[model samples]
Target: MYRIMIADDEPMIRKGLQKLIQQSGQPIASLRLAENGIDALNQIRESCPDFLFTDIRMPKMDGLELCRHTAELDPDIQIVVVSGYNDFEYAQRCLSYGVKEYLLKPISKKTVEAALEKLVYLHSKHTSPAFVSVHRLEEWVGEAEAAIWSLNHETLVKVVQQARVEISSHRLRLHQLIDLLDEFTVLLFKRLHSRDIFLFTERAPLHAADDEDSAWSQFQARLVLFFDELRMKRRGKLKDPVEEAKLYIEAHLAEEVSLEDVAERIGLNASYFSQLFKQSTRETFVQYRTRRRMEKAKKLLAQPHYRITDISGEVGYADHPHFTKTFKKYAGCLPSEYRNKLGIDR
Candidate 1:
């Protein structure tokens, strides 16, 4: 079974091709349609299709550019250009972009079936028994590891799904599929360990299944759940350090605070902590501290009994004039001006 996408500007063409493909009795697992090249590319990025049937000219991005990007994204994808142009230059360019077939407009059932037959043959040839070696398991594991590190759940799930499909299509024995999944899990464990991820504790072993489909389903579920746990653990782990630093900063808002001081208090390297803080809060440590101090100064300025000079000292500013300048920059007015605008007499 193949997942297919059709891209064309004409609604009638898109619907016609979809109908013909459905009626062609091809083993299609799913079908998608796109009104333009850009929409097709976006759909491809979310979930890659086994085959792409696209028109040459569309709004936003053209077919040539879509073909180029699709080739870059997944060279293994079989592309069929369903354009009305019938231009030699377009065919030549598509060939260069690795398009498997080009069908001219006014497509008939015979031509569509022929293209599908050729594409199916090519697909089967590519996924032959010779291609399903033990090395393929390693490739999947490598791809899964990269996805896990990047925290891309969609890509990770897609990798596992592809593995299942390939194993099922190749008719690997139940035992062979289990062995492949076991090896994949072991490899992921070692790779994640090397990166200090350490997700092995309290993990359950793979479940046994009598059928290959059941085995694949169990493996997929276990792997995805494992990744979900890893994501949550890492997320919480990352937040702990940043949260500790934030608490320490809040506690010392009225005192001199430096990035190094907070990093040391949180037991993280200064440079790493700086990067992590910015990534988490979208603010540098200095910027966060300054903003907090200004917020405190604003509250103090609003109190009629608090002198501006005393307010500056209370917010970790030893120099009154400097605090007044910073307050002007931050709030668009000096401390006295701000209080006066608030209708408070000092």
Candidate 2:
């Protein structure tokens, strides 16, 4: 079990962090907490952890000082900053000190899950001497050892990166790799919403390849084609609770929402709604909602009157970095890329 240490000045914050770390999939062998930096330092000398999560500011010894001193105690210990947006600049300073993740306060469960997921992913990816097998690659991609469905950005990055690494390493012969990857991405996508009707499509001609790279490249090209088709096919279209839920989302674009809230609005159970929504849309409700919001966000940003942060919050992202990641995923570029293109590149 991976050990975790959580530190914060506030009792409630520490309590919440403890709960989140427990739920984050990194099982607690021993969890030590401190009210401030000095207490944390004293504890670290006795018991070192694989990871340390600390708030930036506190009464006697703030998180920054704790993070710095903790590293001097154990440079190998991974650190993630848990603080407010105002503390981010200070958090950045901790990076030179060796912090792994910069977490913001008003912490979401998703954010915590993402952080632990990375540590878990890193631990497994680097330590296991096991050869990358077709089945094992898929298995690693799906590890829930903690709940990851609601997580975003970094968690998603870890998942996608693991998938990319296991698949892209030229681990198999070119033709075989393509066939394996072609099947893998397809199954992963379809499995999420397997209960719904799937519009089947033709697969790429793997047998056509006389060489490895050509075959793999052809397969990747086809995969891209298939996703583009899938996206276009699903975009702005509605079925099941999908249409009603999306209408609700679009209508309440600026307000706070939860899975339960959306379910209640449509008089459907959250589990059933989540599954069916993913089934029909080939994306989770959160993903679909974010995609739509980003679509609107891009349009709004293209206009002269909108402020980026205000638009970010309006679209349901409390953090601009979160919004930026969501924007880049759907648009295949950054917001500033779009902005700069309009101002001068055009």
TM-score of each: 0.44, 0.36
Q: Cα lDDT of model 2 overall?
A: 0.68
> How much is the lDDT of residue 302 in candidate 2?
80
In the range 92-128, model 2's lDDT, one tens digit per residue, is 6989898888887788999999988887777556435
- Model 2 misplaced regions, further than 4 Å: 124-346
Model 1 lDDT tens row, 127-231: 566246767878898899898778898998899878777777765534446666777787876777687655432224455565667777766665664565466
Candidate 1 local accuracy as lDDT?
0.81
Task: Please give the distance, in angstroms, between residue 20's alpha carbon in candidate 2 and its true position after superposition.
Answer: 1.4
